[model samples]
Target chain A: MKKALAMLLLVLVGTLLFMGIYAMEGFRPYGEVDLAQRVSQAYIDKDVTGENPEVVYGISKDLETGSANLVTSIIVNYRSFDTLGEVTVLFLSALGVSILFGSFKGRLRSRYQPNFILRTGSKVVFPLILIMGVYIFIHGHLSPGGGFPGGSMIASAILLMYLADEAFRIRIEGFKMTEGIAGSLYVLLGLVGLTLAGYFLSNFLNTGTVGALFSAGIIPVVYVLVGLKVGSELTGIITDFLKGEVE
Target chain B: MINPVLLIAIPLLLAFVSILYKGYRNNLLVFGALVNAGLVLTLGKGEYLIGGFKPPFGINLVLDDYAFLGLLVINGLFLLITLMSLDKIGENATVLLVALAGLNGLLLTGDLFNLFVFLEITAITAYILSASSRQYQHSFNYLVLGTLGSGLYLFGLILLYAVFGSLNMADLSLKMATADTSQLVIPSLLIFIGLGVEVKILPFNGWVRGVYGNSDSLVGPLFSAVYAGAMLLVFGRIFAQVIPLGAYLKTLLLLLGALTLIAGELAALSKTRIREILLYSSIGQSGLIVTLFLSGLVFPAVMQLFNNILSKAVLFTVAGQMADTTGTDDAEALQGAFARHKLAGVAFTIAGLSLIGMPLFYGFVSKINLLFGVFSLDNYWLPGVILLGTVIEGTYLIRLLVKLWMPGEEGLVSHESHATKAPLEIQRARVMGIVVLSAVLLVGGLMPGMIQNNLSESGRLLDETTPVYLFDLKGGQ
Candidate 1:
């Protein structure tokens, strides 16, 4: 009876809400007179020309931030404040998982260790994967991949080791310290931008010539910090998940 | 003229550093909080363009009058809670600091997406902090509900961005004026639901009880007083500035607020546990604040919010102590607790009187203001409902007081005999914290005029700080 009543009420409210929404202007069938398309039309034009008065000196994001990847430029330089918060959210999630699962204190291991081939393959492939992760973040401003994807890549490598070696134990404290330092530096760099220029997280350093590896002022630097911080935090989370029980 | 970003950046820096220096996490947090409080005090009002980017292109932070008042209340409550919970908080100190950073961002950020990001920061850390209790499931519930609400909020932002083509509040306000009103309906509802979740709007707030009931004594009040205050202020800003409200929207909010108040009061009356009663009362008070807010009475809404914060801080802290001493939160178990813990009883009585809106209490002034606001609208039904809720509120609180002092369980009723009936000792520090809060409540009530000028100024500032006015100011700078 209760379930039926709830369903009935839900349907009623949903219908009323939809009816109300239909009464508003500008909402039309998809692909018909797309009003939303015009909203970002100016931005798209700026993205193409690489010049918009919305930024400093009418310099394009490519010239100002020097990041080839528009998304990377957006995430790290133009709207870095949101990225700061996004990083904290990921860090907090890791912390919460660890708090609930406790630090892995050499607890119960896998029931069956991977065969010899799997173990040997993971060990040999680990450093190569780590280097790839580092490369991604280092080239975040000039390439497709950035901090979050790169960090997850490194964490995946660590997860491979956890699967291969049943007795391998990570020193949770060391990982924690790395995460903390990297997170702190991200903020410190933003503060540096604040003191050097008038704005917080402003590109205080020179926006080197476009397409250069060392370009984009603090964009690449912040991305690298985020990459390292996210990598270690994710590793900590995986280790906690694999560990059996919390004390 | 301190940079408002430092309000967020400094504590985050200290919190991160404290991880490497665990032994000093508590002291580091305390020091950082004091610095934050100092910065907020000296901070001048302005719009801070982040990354040297202009509005409509980059995120900005604002420190207008409403935000300044929010900062003071948030920082003041955080300092008190940190001092009171230093010994009991354990590893949660870092989490608390991070949550404070999130709250600061929530109050100051000027963009819609940035607001969403800060909302996640606050929710994630609060989930961890609230999960410290044995009821871990409650934290999981909080995570699910909070995430769902934020998801809806993000969807709304996407819709607004699609139609209006901007994420900055000022920019959006400029475009939204001519945008399709039909396209905005879904987004506005989504955002309202998202922000309302934090303020404990009814029907959508299933996780409230589990969170408030399970969090440690200090954290419960922190969530209620500081966290809720920030969220409420943000909600008010959105309605007053970002989205111009239609009559239909206002009426919808008013009805929801009335329902929430009645439901909360009835739930409080039904609950046997003392902490649960206080939790429901907290919800009811928030409901009252929301109702006044939706009525377009910004001043009285803020005043009521202040009263709720001060009184809840005292009530929740004392209830935590009482529960600790009695070993159970059942009202029957707390009979004669006044004899054993005189200080707690005194603090509870003062806070209770304030919550009941007795004359000479801040609650009384705020309540009268709210009534006037409602009466001016010629809305007899709302005033009638409010009076009914208040009557219901008075009956339960008075009943609790009787149970508290009327000795030996004579009028007290218990479903089961509590095992740990012996009164445990109370901590001097917690008692001291409650005494300080009580004094603030008394002083605020006795000298209401001291804040009248500032309150009216902030109330006027609330509407004047709209996006259009702010956008004009931005050009001069």
Candidate 2:
């Protein structure tokens, strides 16, 4: 009865949200809204600080924000502090897992024995998976995939190994060190910006050209750090959970 | 020239580094806390932009009067709580460091989305802190509710962003002032429910009882003073200064606050357990402060917030100590727990008295100002509700204090012979910390002038300092 009532309430809420959103001028059926009238346009145009010409594919030089990916420009450049915070959220979650499961001695053994190909296949796949993860985070400024997804991909590789071979255990201490170093470097990079310039997390490097791999000066660097931190933290969480008492 | 971001950054840096040096994490936590508290003193009034971008475009940390004062009190209390309970911190030191960063971020951020990010960071750290008791059930409940609360807040914030196309607090306020505020009602209500969970409003605070009731001395004071104070200040910032509210929404929220206040006090009145009483009292105090904020009485609301948090810090510490020592916080079981520790006892008594708004204590100053603020707004009925809540609150607190201080049977005179045998062992550091907090209360009550000068002089925006700061920003004098 309670579940039914809650479900009904949810449906009512969904209906109201639809009505309310459509009623507002800003949310006027999404497609009818002018992109030029939006704040995101300024972000894409790279004109928050000073005026800029239209961004080009591989030609825009010394733009305010240098990321070709508009989302990356917003997440990494315009509002990097919030990204830092988002990373801390994941870090805290991983820390919570370790704290709760720190005392456990070893990994939980799988109930079924792994097949011959499965164990061998995971070992083969792990390196390839790690390279893919690196690629995703490295190209985060020019592509849709960023640190969060790339890091999750790395953790998924770890998870695969754990599933395939019951005795597979990576040293969590290494992951902890990686997470710590990566996180500190991210902040230190921001502080460097603060020291040289007057702002924090400032892109103090040369923006050669848009659509280039070397472009978006600090965005890629921060993304790489985030990828490392998130990867290690997620891996730590996975190891901690595997160490939990199996039912 | 010290950026306010360092207050947040230093702690986070320490927290990240602490993960590598597990043995020396406690030292890092202490160093970070001291640095943060020291840095807060140097912060003046201005907006510090991040990522080298301007406001409403990039994130900024606003060091307005509200944020500056909030940072001072929070970092001060956090430092004291951390130093006093170093033994209780154990493995939770790094978690505590991250929590400090999160709290500072919560107070300092001017971007709504950035605030949500800090909110999540703070809430997640709090979830870890809550799990320290090993009562996984309550912690789980808190996790679920807190996550849901933040989600609702994000939902509301997304709606606002959709309408305004901006996330900066000052920018949003300017836009909201000119917009049709009737469009704000649903999103406003959603935001309230999100904040209500953290603020311990009625029906939304089911997890407070178990978590707070089971808290140790370190977690107790930190949660009560530091976390509660930060959340209320942020609440005031968002609702009072930013979100332009219409008539119906204001009334609805104000009523919710009043109901929460009355209900919290009534429930607290019936509790026999010392920790439960203190926790419920905290809930009631939160409600009153929220009501003050909703009424647009910023000064009195801030006064009450600090007063409540400071008093609750002392009160919860003592109660938690009792529960920690004797394994039970039953007021009857732990009768005369303070008989051995006279200093802690006096501090607890003073904090309780102040909380109940007794004369010559800071709570009295806060309460009087609160009533005066309400009355000046031509709010007649609220005073009646507030006074009635105070009377009930006093009755329970005094009864608890009397039982803790003097423990004779009902038929006989209160005597030392009837003191609790439960071996209450409050450390020297803890005692000194509570004494210092309670002394501030006593001194604040006597000299409210110092606080007033800070407020009237430094708190207001666009004062002499802001013009200079803006001139510096625009690269001119």
Candidate 3:
């Protein structure tokens, strides 16, 4: 009976979905020109001319936030509130994994470690990987890579070291400090913006000449903090996953 | 003008900072909850812009009556539930605070994408907390379902953004009102499917029973009351207001809601376990609330949600205590429950009665309002369907009450008590929490006028604020 009911509901839903699709009008595919007629057009306009003189006339993403990369501007500046939420999502996942794996008191190190060559190579490449991650986040406003990607990169490097040396203990204390400080700094900066510019997470600081490494007001600074936070959080999650729970 | 952003910010900050103070984590959670409750109660209404940018550009945080009510419910309940779960939720305290932050963001965000982000945060945190119990498979199932729901929800947002070229709720609403609504059909359906999963509407709620049953009972109220309440209101805001519901869509919601109501009631009627019973009833109540909202009975929808929060808070907390004392959560274990614990038994009876929509209870008013809404819509059959569901709901709930008041079995010991035991102080604290919840329910039942007036005003605000334009910010700082 349950299966029959399920099938019946499925058929109804499928029919309704089909009717809905058939009824919809003027829904264009991605990159259609009609999109240029709506609000995103203003964004595109601002992206091209650096000013939208029609709607919020004379206010442009370039002039207001000064991030050359549009996605970075959107993620870090235009909708930083969502970015904060995304950070919380990562933080919660990490906390959850840690709690799940935190039951065992003793460390459950890997039974087999990598060979000498792999260990030696990981040790040599770890700092270099860290530098690259830092660079990616720092240049986030001007380039493609930003906090999330950069953080994942750094965490993967750390994971490599863990595999290379089973006894290489994670200084959870340092990671905790880094994650806390970085996450709190993002909120603090937003609050600071509230005080300075009367808007939460506003571009309170000066947006230097565009295309510069240090430009885009607080975007780079926030992204850097986000990078450090995500890096530490991902490292913590990976660490917990490596230590499987006892049966 | 308090920045409503601070509500989300402060909790998130404390959640991260509490990690540093591992020894005093509970203290940090308590402090955070207290501050949030206070701020939410005192914060004035206004549009608070984020990133110093205007709407349709930078995200705006709304502080209207709808958002205000959600804030109060979430933060207020968090403080109470925090007190209840203090000893039980150890390292999971941070997750709770973060989840509260996500909920606050969900209530306050004026941007569609921001809503999606906060929804993901809440879903992820819930998944982690739910999976922390012995039944990992259930939580895993919940996580997979929730993630799929969120994926579809995000896809819907993309479609909306594609058609309207905006992500702000108000902007999208304004555009959708003027645009060809036929163009919105697919997107709206996608969103309904997505929100259906989150809000536990019928067949989409394959996850409800296991997660509620297996998780720590102390946190059960948080799921059934706080999380479910906020999500239902958001569902109303987005569907009943943001998108102009076409006739076909309205019929879809109404039928689905009535079907869900019957399905939930039947499931609950067949169940003899405590958590499963509450879980199914909760789903049934959500269906009723959704039906109310879809029928344009704003007052009853809000009233039902408020009443559900109170009753569930009372029932779940008391039920958790009953389960803890008796060892098993089965209905048979409830025999002589009143003899063992008088306060919990009475609390359960009053709350159970309210759930049955008895006279002098707030549920009675909500049920009347729901009936009026169904009739006023000129839908004659819906009332019959609703009444039938209520009858089934009442039969099982009354049966449970009888079980609770029954005499003890001589020489029969509860077999499960030996497995888990909590200290006396924790038990006392939990019962105290139950007392507070039941007190509110009593006060609400006796003076239904006050809460009804307030909820009606909120309902009026909800009705008036269709196409909520929250971007008219005044001078700040």
Interface RMSD of each: 3.1, 1.2, 2.5
Q: Candidate 1 regions off by >4 Å?
A: A1-62, A245-247, B178-180, B408-421, B456-477
Q: List the residue pairs that clash in candidate 2.
A: none
Q: What value of lDDT does candidate 1 attain over all alpha carbons?
A: 0.79
Backbone clash count for every predicted candidate, in the order shown: 3, 0, 0
Looking at model 3, the pairs that clash are: none
Q: Which 10 successive residues of model 1 chain B have the least lDDT summed?
A: B468-477
Model 1: DockQ against the native? 0.54
Q: For residue B223, give model 2's deviation from the true position in Å.
A: 0.9
lDDT of 2 by residue, A1-247 (tens): 9999999999998898778767766555567656565578788678999988888889988888789988999898888898999998999999998899988866677679999999999999999999999999999999899898999999999999989987787988899999999999999999999998779899998766888999988989999999999899999988898886744
Question: Candidate 3 residues B60-171, lDDT tens each?
Answer: 8877766787788778887898897677786687888788888999898988899999899988888877865657899889989999899889888888876677898888
Please give the RMSD of candidate 2 to the true structure. 3.4
lDDT (tens digit, per residue) of candidate 1 on A1-247: 9999999998997897678656655545566655335534433333422454543422344456677676787889778999989998898888788777774555556668699999999999999999999999999988899899999999999999889887677887998999999999999998888888878888888876666787888989899999999999999889888877443
Model 3: residues >4 Å from true position, as ranges? A1-24, A45-62, A104-113, A245-247, B408-426, B454-477
Query: What TM-score would you report for chain A in candidate 2?
Result: 0.92
Give lDDT tens digits, candidate 1, residues B1-477: 689999899889888888889899888889988988888888877788898777677888877766777898889888887887677787777888898899999999889999999999998888888877767798889889999999988977876775565798877876777665556667888888887788888977889999887656777778878888888888876765677555677778778888999999999999878889988988888788778766667667777788888778877777776665556777876765666677777877778888888888777877787787778875879999889888988899988877776654444463224323556566887778878888777777898887776554443232354545331111110
TM-score of each: 0.91, 0.96, 0.90
* Residue B394 Cα positional deviation in candidate 2, in Å, after optimal superposition: 1.0
Docking band of candidate 3: medium
